[model samples]
Target: MSHHMTKNHPDSPNGQDDISKNDSGNPTIHEIIDIRLSRRGLLKGGAGMVAGGFMSMGLSACVSDSSKTATTAKGFSLGFTAVAKSLNDVLSVPTGYTASILYRTGDPINGATPAYVNDGTDTAASFDFRAGDHHDGMAYFGMASGGSGMDLNNSSRGIVCMNHENINQQFLHTAAEAGVGFSTAARVAAQIDKEVNAHGVSVIEISKAGGTFSVNTASTYNRRLTAASDMDIYGPARGDTLMVTSYSNAGQKTRGTLNNCAMGITPWGTYLTCEENWAGYFKRPASGGLSAKMATAQNRYIGSSSSNGSYGWANPTGGDTSGTGLYDRWNINLTGADATADYRYAANTFGWVVEIDPFAPASIPRKRTALGRFGHEGAMPAPAVAGKPVVFYMGDDSRGEYIYKYVSTANWSSADVGGGLAAGNKYLDDGKFYVAKFNSDGSGSWVELNIANPTISGYATYAFANQADVLINCRLAADAVGATPMDRPEWTGVNPSTGDIYITLTNNSDRGKTGTTTGGKSRGLDAANPRYYSDLKGAATQTGNVNGHIIRIRESAKDHSATTFQWDIYLFGAEAGADATNINVSSLTADNDFSSPDGLWFSRAVPGLMWLQTDDGAYTDVTNCMMLAALPGTMGDGAATTITNTAVPANGNANQTVATIAGKKATTDTLRRFLVGPKGCEITGITETPDGQTIFVNIQHPGENTALADVASNTTASFESHWPDGGNARPRSATVVITKNGGGLIGS
Candidate 1:
């Protein structure tokens, strides 16, 4: 999500309110990058150094070490002409590719449901059978040709599980509905019902015929799990007191999952839908006599104690006629006497990685607490090796947060293929969680985040009563263990060809800012987060790492369980014409430059191919968000270098320096723009078929910038974008299928 979209509402779901309180005094990534660059004598030069200095070094192009330099993947080169940047109200793909709308917001997933009316007159109950809004982070599970079960090799038929992260309130309702307290505490019950049912995840069947994919409206597997759905709590914190709520006295169950972002797939054929920015959905006022323990946890995990909650999900009056506390559950204030009396602990039930069995629609989703609670962007599992433990890499999607990995106690086995939730119970219930600690030598270590660690149990900031407490408050433990604070860690993915893990450190506004800690914690540039400058977006001047960067780590000796790993900056997001000395460190050209890298996934069928998506605001003035294809070489492919950052006028107009290990600058042969999304929309959530011939990409929140006043006034000409179904229709978030013109491999 883009911060610029909600600048007026700081408490909005994707806003920067849920920042890190990592005052651990541990060295940040910027400091490590500075140490390494200085040790290699890379920062000795002045600020006038040219970007070509890195290209002249001629680094290795292989994705692995020197021993595997000659074994490049079969399709290592980008084959299509790069799409030019566009501000059009429609998706733009490469010249040889065709993109067709596959699914959209409010589209019916079942044959019995009525077609979407686009005028917002559809019944609130009908959205339960329709596709949710803001399509994001999807995966394809191949279906057997004979309509039996899953078949990994099948490409023509499959089920798509996608996250409907949020809704566009203005567009989803009519003018009269908005005037009836949609944005206030007295929100209309019918409007709130529609909004609540429009969130969470959606699973629909789709098939390919004549090179086009369409939703299978009559498939028995089609279903939508919304914010009001019932789910089971699993793992260490299942019966813990912290999870207790009015709905679940045993704390073993909860209603609904919110803010579902990126997703992952388990070897047992289950979907891992992560919950990001979920804290914003709760209201926790300071007037409630909040205990010190509760306040500490709330201020650290959620932001400010005076929050009114995003969208006022807790405000519908006298609405729970069924005694289910449907609307009251969103209020986390300690109004009642105990945890069982009110929903004070309801927020804790959220923010965990939820596992859903798409194949079995009746199965209940489970919240995997073993993965540690935070604003999880995605949980990317490392390739499951027989007899080895199942491993997953995760990122906390907030500024100055940490990257974490989970190693299940149970080893992987092929026999668990169809085990579903039972397999999830076996492999996801007991796991050793660790957070990354990057060192100045370019090597990193995974620090254990368990209460058993002396640093965690003996901490003075917050008391850990048990393992459940530690898992529930793992961010505090990470701070206690001195984990490295990253630059707004987002989607994480593991390279299929090399077993390397990559995490997108989406831009941080607080980086390199001079002053006492503000907007999370402030610090100067470092090796892993080396770039810091000012960006002019429209009339507003944005500072810090205006254009984010991606960092990758390779486990020692190719072992997923290794505590040590080596890391490097894979690519820096910058405009093609930015200053080459400091900002455009990646040496990107017009054909491949990007900003605020968000969604990332390495192709399972295309060997070393990787897809990079953007959720940008700084660069939106020039172009809409986009997706790019890359044959990214592995870690250590480039040398250490120095970046001399020049502060904007707002930051004192002084120059500062930092050292970083830069990857080999991307070229036209290795990276190119594949698609650009519609105006005011973000290009994210991508997956392809087994044959790599068809790819599904999600366009989130199209026309998101449209003002509520404009929608209320019916000012059609003032709309930012009307995409997918264009002629005067309201813009909608949709999933589109992209394929090569004649059904050859996509991006080839």
Candidate 2:
């Protein structure tokens, strides 16, 4: 999850912090956009969400002060005792559940392709037609049945699409060894080609027969979208000057999608593959940095001033000039004789919401830039009600970032179910964008990001010329408004049985790091962001909210497009041995304790059932990351909690020593651990069939801690795990399908 922290992508400044640069455009294009989120409150001097630990409550979203229980809370039991934690290198489920390998890295896609050899000898070219590394965020699109759109109940046969978040270098090459960079290896063109081809998303067909699920590679729907595939641009910014590349002088086209993390499934039967941490993958020449127009844009998202990236694909020891535009594409330095001559504008094409149709392999993907670009974690849609505007909730996965939402101009309808890209035009594009502001007092507001608003137009900190400029430089716009900064925001999930939406705030080490955070941002404990602590892992001390927590919100009046919301902390992640009063604020026991809430999903087939997964470091000493099942109660079920942080203080800020936080608590009967993964692994990427009888989950980067020196001997003993392919063999990122041994509904 923090892979970007280790690698230096000279051309990509995706996660790095930088100041804004210059722009060349007409100064009056902001006239055509929507601006209600700001005009109503922010522009009129309305108080925004602030940095306070707690505040007195005064209002409500739906339920009144007398009772905080949501109208749709589920208090049913999970029905199973929690699974025991273990260090074994295998996927474990409840005793009645069985699991099998569905697919793994290097696995072939069609009948002509051979099986995965599970070694480092496979040809780099072969990976172009195989499953990729680091599987993440997937959704099941039921069979379209030839033009009637999709039947959500078609559980027998369907299409599955998933993201290949990033690469695992040690296992990706033929002669990988410690101390030698995979991209720096001799004659790395082939190796570079393989990694690039394997970094996007894959669409495969799956069908159930008798009792097992199998991939039908021969199906015409089987396909792969690499980082170099041709795609069209959509939304108001599609034909703008910022997108004028040699590939599309008209600024209507671009190539490939990169760093795809979490994704979303649309009600219109399409999939939204999110581009995350995409800024730091390219390098710009120092001289090119002089072009304030381009540099200004790059600095906002962090464009490195070097000529190489994490892999040196553009400037490898072996000349990149001989390749089929393959190697040169990685370099975004202005050395390109012109926009067309070099990939100077190539970086502009990435970092947007990419829409793909899994049922139609021949269809071109569209980069919907109107969604307000940043390090998009994922997009989760509110319940789609006919005649109502579709609402999508998204999070920017970075430290001290803001949460956003997009409200479509078009209303929902069944007729547009199979409309495909046309449906995207009706909903994904031309929307009102707003950032969230959480108040310590339970109430929160959605701050509009409209340039026309006086709050934005009157601000002199940054330049906002038009709607296109506003969308391109969204982070700056969010900052101009008083959006509440948060911990590392990850995946978001919404309850179908209830209108409540939940977002996972992964741990943030910098929270309350120093008295003065230096960047004008405060890291002190606030009512909305309550906990701050330090933890010891081995010899290193992990600080801030080490275990992380989950926040749930209900829209005012239960309306998806409501500008206000009522929220509370749903659960606080922690180790079973942690203090119940301070660390384990949710009062979690051995059966429900967990940390670093990362991946979250609601069972589409099982109403009221939510699946919670983790990607942890603070508690690995006890067991690896795992997934849990919860029958969640409403946000107001429990009383507010107060934490007295007693850690070493820095900067000018002293120990809070006392901070009262408000949030509901989770009981053992309401939530229980369902499965534990192997050592050195993260449990992520989850989905299930419409019937809820079969579920698919990804085990990413297993045995990732193995040192390169240990793997040189090429033995299973050199690694920390080899389950799912037991015996002396290398471990691979794989998708496991789990089902009840007696055919019961999952989580039933």
My TM-score estimates for the predictions, one after another, are: 0.92, 0.87
Whole-model alpha-carbon lDDT for candidate 1: 0.81
Which candidate comes out best when scored by lDDT?
1
Q: Ten consecutive residues with minimal summed lDDT in candidate 2?
A: 54-63
Per-model lDDT? 0.81, 0.71
For residues 62-174, what per-residue lDDT tens digits would candidate 2 score against the true structure?
A: 11111111222343445544576656665666655556778788887787778878666677667667898878889988885554346778877788898887776666764
Estimate the TM-score for candidate 2. Answer: 0.87
Q: How do the residues 359-381 of candidate 1 rate in per-residue lDDT, one tens digit apiece?
A: 89989999999999998899999
Name the lDDT of candidate 2.
0.71
Runs of candidate 2 with Cα error greater than 4 angstroms are: 1-76, 144-149, 176-180, 183-187, 285-288, 291-296, 303-307, 322-324, 337-341, 516-518, 649-653, 657-661
Clashing pairs in 1: 30-526, 33-527
